[model samples]
Target: MDFRFGDEDETFRAQARAWLADRLADDPAPDPRAWERALGRAGWIGLGWPGTDGRGYGNRCATLAQQVVWAEEYARCAAPARLGHIGENLLAPTLIAYGTEEQRRRFLPPVARGEELWCQGYSEPDAGSDLAGVRTAAVADGTGGYAVTGQKIWTSLARDADWCFVLARTEPGSTRHRGLSFLLVAMDQPGRIEVRPIRQMTGTSEFNEVFLDGARAAEVVGGEGNGWAVAMGLLALERGVSTLAQQIGFAAELEKVVSAAVASGAVGDPVVRAGLVRQWAELTTMRRHALRTLGATGDPGAPSVAKLLWGGWHRRLGELAVQVAGAAGAVGPGPWSPERPYELDEAQRLFLFSRADTIYGGSDEIQRNIIAERVLGLPREPG
Candidate 1:
């Protein structure tokens, strides 16, 4: 594979880098919703959408390489983490692939405009890693829509989202992957949907527990009983273009860790220095692998491999962050109380969040099983 960025890609990269530098130099708003709209208006939102969506929805259909360039530049400039990414990268693409023309027309424009935010309702209290085990049910409401009821756990952006793409059982007596559906639900149904934030040990509520008591699913994508495929496809996207952006963020974290090591004089230890060098080398490898597999949709193993690579790498980096910080990284800034808890510093937050890097999205064990059984054609593990 050619590693070089073509002239056009370089041009796009320059534009992306310049725009990010200018916009990210100062905080425009504390809220990321405003930032999402700004990106939408600039035609920077859906960088990899298919061309000529032509209705002038304002989505820029850049090439795969350009997409990578934009993601890298976006992270390099330390731009605020995108809140619309779930909509633009996952839901929008899934809709384009499997949704009706009306659904696309209704949905894509708002996402491109960043007028809405979306959260995923895939994992349930009982279903998580075993995605097919979802117990959430969606029954026809006798109108054009269906009423969704059940619970979704670890739902990112649930409180702040304007919509949620839910995976639910549509048919009675359905089990596992059968009779499932990909549902598009608006989050504004008052008195029906409830979002209770799950506070993390890091003193943040980035995840939530969502209760849907007859919440309405206004649209269904990929038809009824085909949700497994759609959900897997979305997961594949999660492992694709977004992985590159994640790596860029990982790179930034690594840089900060190194800087912290230097400032703390931990670089004097040969072991610490060696660990840092190993991390740099592994990150470089991951970047190249992501580039090579960026467009390799036929390679079923790529996504799992990418997940495993970054998951373990990030967990180790968290350990190194604490190690390099010596004893100081473990302490909090102030006394803790129910009304006022301790604040986590950058390294502490990194360490705490990274602890789940191997668990969420897909666990490390699950990824290995996927690679082994699906990619290597090995016998399935014993139950």
Candidate 2:
């Protein structure tokens, strides 16, 4: 468990840090798309994707540790939140793994260049955690593609996305995980797709409900009726080096919580002080576990374990944040008018947003079930 970065990795880190510093130096409020394009042009977007060109860093082929270094440096620099993460981190890898050559050529470039954006269409109103229970239907449209019809809730960044990778029941009588197909649907087709923002407690709509009525899939990845495997594979990718970068961001948030506690004198309270200490220690342990599991193969339990640890830890951190804020946490934005009304502060937004940390990706209960059934070989829960 050597945590130190090798010499090459350190060199990569220094390069990444310098590039980010130079890019972020000029524009204090750079447009997200512009920033993403800058990163993409600089060949910093897809570190793990194959195929090297003059436009990409893919030529060098970064190792997992190198990817981790870039991720850490990116977070440490507080660069603009990635606008192409769904495309680069999640969908691109899945595409490389399961997509055809044509599909790869068509989709991978935009993602690598940060020119196109993607949103996942997996969770539905009735099938949030139970992905096997997805009811979105994608029937053959007489042509080669399928006509998708259903609603997807909790779709992150759906409003601004150019495309959506959806899990739909391609078979008429399909139930549970069976008969599912992974369909890539265009989001701009007028009258076929709709996106409604889901306003959160934080007064922002980072998530949305997307409705597809006779929407057309551009193509199906991993073949028709084999979506369950593809979807599961994508989920596994969700637990990759990005998790290390995410932990870096979490460390930032935890620092804010501690700083808030100190500024508000909550650190004087023994219980609050102890909670901060425990949180710091747990975050360190989580990072070690994440690093250790980087090269693990064929372990069904790793992703679930990672999810369970981070989800609960984040939820607890949120509670601690609000607790440290004390009475001030109870107050939210004031009424708005023409000019300015109300806005949530950093701590308030953290408390509100982190409320969904345990529920969104996969519920705590679901993660437990996965760990039990797959990892420990325990009996499956009776439906």
Q: Which candidate is the best by lDDT?
A: 1
TM-score of 1: 0.95
Cα lDDT of all candidates, in order? 0.88, 0.88
The number of the candidate with the highest TM-score is: 1
Q: What is the lDDT of candidate 1?
A: 0.88
Poorest 10 consecutive residues by lDDT, candidate 1: 49-58
What lDDT, from 0 to 1, does candidate 2 have?
0.88
User: Alpha carbon lDDT of residue 7, candidate 2?
Assistant: 92
Cα-based lDDT at residue 81, candidate 1: 75
| Pairs in clash, predicted candidate 1 | none
Q: In model 1, what is the error at residue 350, expressed in angstroms?
A: 1.0
Count backbone clashes in candidate 1. Answer: 0
TM-score of each: 0.95, 0.95
